[model samples]
Target: MATFATSEQLLVIIDPAARQTDGESVRIAKDVLSAGAATKVCLPDGPEEFARALGRRGSRRPVVIGDDRALVRAVTVLHRARELAGCALSVVPVGDTALAESLGVPRGAVAAARAVLDGSERRLDLLVDDSDGVVLGGLGIPPEPVRAAAPEPVTAAAGRTWYRSLVRTLAPGRPRLPAVPSPGPSRLRVEVDGAAVVDLGQPVEAVSVAPGTGGLARVEVRPLSVGAEATPVRACGQTVTVIGADFRYRADAAVSGPVRRRTWRVAEGAWGLTLPTGS
Candidate 1:
């Protein structure tokens, strides 16, 4: 069950974004897939329909055809249904394929379709959050907020001539300030497996949690530093927790929420993905 049979029946889920991004690639993928497997093509118009389509897939293998978001959505749907471990998922990268490439799926439509027809399923680790959110790749805490630009008064003596005035009128510019330590570092309490790795007393630059080898999550906390660079506090554990002021995080390709706290635990080999043989 770890690899698809050469002619396995496939439920091909064509994401909306894929059709809008490139119809030619979609057609090519469909043609290639239909030529090989007994494929049932599904063109889901929205997220809800997509989930419904996947949920109703029965025993057929789900082959997502879209970008990273589409793949993530599929994973999330199956994970929530508590059937991800038994489901071997495949993807035909149609738009943004960076995540697929990292996961060992080919970049183009034809290559990915071919691999789907002839590839092995590899069980991969995933992170499940307290909110039942699924993270296929990784997650990070405290994405830097965009800073507001302050207007600097133009001095008469040091004033730029007509070019500067014209530029100011055309596009108000922010000062190119040198990169310096943030005036205020985020005060987050980071804990791995219930042991406080970084207490609330210490301010941190960022915190990262990702699936590591052997069913453990690799957690790293970067302390706010002045002067010399400080080494990140690192640990590997089954669970990682971050608590502090409301903050946002980048999980995989999307930004989550301004939550006061969140915890993620690793599910070892929680899901299977179809990758190129020997990948």
Candidate 2:
């Protein structure tokens, strides 16, 4: 008679980032996982190998041992193959994990690996874009600005401007220097679930969209120059479309676009993630 307790089997894909950073953490996770499961490990150097590693995942649960971006990459691969819905994914975050934190994945290699061994699967909603891009956590319109390019090493004109300022310090009759122009609010035509919420003529302070339960994305638009009491417009819908001048948005950890238009629709319970029990 077979006396060994049945052990779960897992294919652990160790991302390049995990191998490069916190090697000890990765080792701990590997040790714990090996002890609990029948393990097959794939150390991929880049995205191509990563996808291939997952593609060859046969009869084994796929587990990712990297940070948030690694999780997104795995999801995208399975998504493109249309296999995500049937496959459950587990992640052991080992790098900057803003995405993991937002998705409620427990931190620490040991705990996360344990979750992989003992946790249950939870089906979650997703936002799929027109470009076939996937948004795991959420997306922001007109992403936080990048640091401006270094000023032209103080040239003659700038020196003259400084001289003018010094002269003004000695004389009250000098004209004040011109101020640098700040950016104005963005102009976008926002639509939700076939209803137009804001038009192009209306400038917006900010835009945010996040996945919600039951196949919907929570859409919010902050209008520019509204009264102090005017709150942002918030609604839930299945589709969100934005049209305007070229703009960019931050999705997960990456920034995309300067495109004229973008649309996202919800796919309900599109994928399953392994989460700690009672979590």
Candidate 3:
């Protein structure tokens, strides 16, 4: 880990969508970071501008102020710039909390900012797709229903606001399993490191690949559930190949493919991040 200079600057990128919904919190985060040691706050209007600002990040630490999507975007830019290997990236999560919580970032803005000021740098694995794009978290094939079921902007806001209270009240009435109409699984041929692993015509509901221990890749296949427990197929490899009919997949929340084949290779510890302790 590189030791940051005492007078090092900090660049902040706030997501545009987040700003529209909750600009005050964004402003508060900026104020707190600015008041901290040798930090400068930057508010990029959009992703393109954010990339431009980050391209010149230099020796200053970069702090992202938005949801998980925004954090992923920042990491992508830094990785492309080849700065991620040396620079520490921090995130002040806003909007959706799922990804941030999984990554161990604090929920509140003030606490997240404090984390930025007092955090250790660590090397985290980044998934690079066939296109050479980096994914911060695990990628999914045939994206989760929740992502596809996202409502309109206004409706989504209302849903999130009332989701907790509504779920609490209706928990007992809700069915344990969702009435998922079985989209019969398409045939897929999977190979790990150029060797065949799974060659079946079963219903593959979803497939995902993530980094495992010792820099090996862990591949998981979730076939259509026959019983209560969905059989999980796991494999370890350096390279993964998936060939099937046109099917879309979510790579770190962003939808990617409908192609016949996609390959993913493990780029171990390709980037570094500045995160709260025990993240």
Return the top candidate by TM-score.
1
lDDT of 1 by residue, 1-279 (tens): 366786668999999877765666788999999999898999999899999999999979999999888999999999999999779999999766667788789988899999999989999999999999988778777654434344445666445334344554465332332322333578999889999999999888888888988999998999989899999999999998889888778787677778999999999999999988887
Candidate 3 wrong stretches, greater than 4 Å: 1-6, 147-183, 225-230
lDDT of 3 by residue, 1-279 (tens): 444443568877777756654555677788888887676566777789889888877767788888777888888887777777777788888766566667667787888887787776767666676877766677777666543324323346646545533543454431122322324565677788998666766767777887665567888887778778687888888888888888666676566767888888877877666667655
Candidate 2 achieves a global lDDT of 0.83
- In what order do the candidates fall by lDDT, top score first? 1, 2, 3
What C-alpha lDDT values do all the predictions have? 0.84, 0.83, 0.71
Deviation from native of the Cα of residue 7 in model 2, angstroms: 1.9
Error of 3 at 17 (Å): 2.0
Segments in model 2 whose C-alpha atoms lie over 4 Å from true places: 1-6, 145-184, 226-230
Better of 2 and 3 by TM-score: 2
- Clashes (backbone N, CA, C under 3 Å), per candidate, total 0, 0, 1
Cα RMSDs, all models: 10.9, 13.7, 7.1
Report the C-alpha displacement of residue 245, candidate 1, in angstroms: 0.6
Model 3 residue 208 CA deviation in Å: 1.9
TM-score rank, highest first?
1, 2, 3
If scored against the real structure, what TM-score would every candidate get? 0.84, 0.83, 0.81
lDDT string for model 2 (1-279, tens) is: 112222867899999877665566788999999999899999998999999999999989999999878999999999999999789888999866778867767888899988888888888999999999899889888675534323323358647445534543454431222332324689999999989989899898788999999999999998886667457899899999999898778787677878899999999999888888778
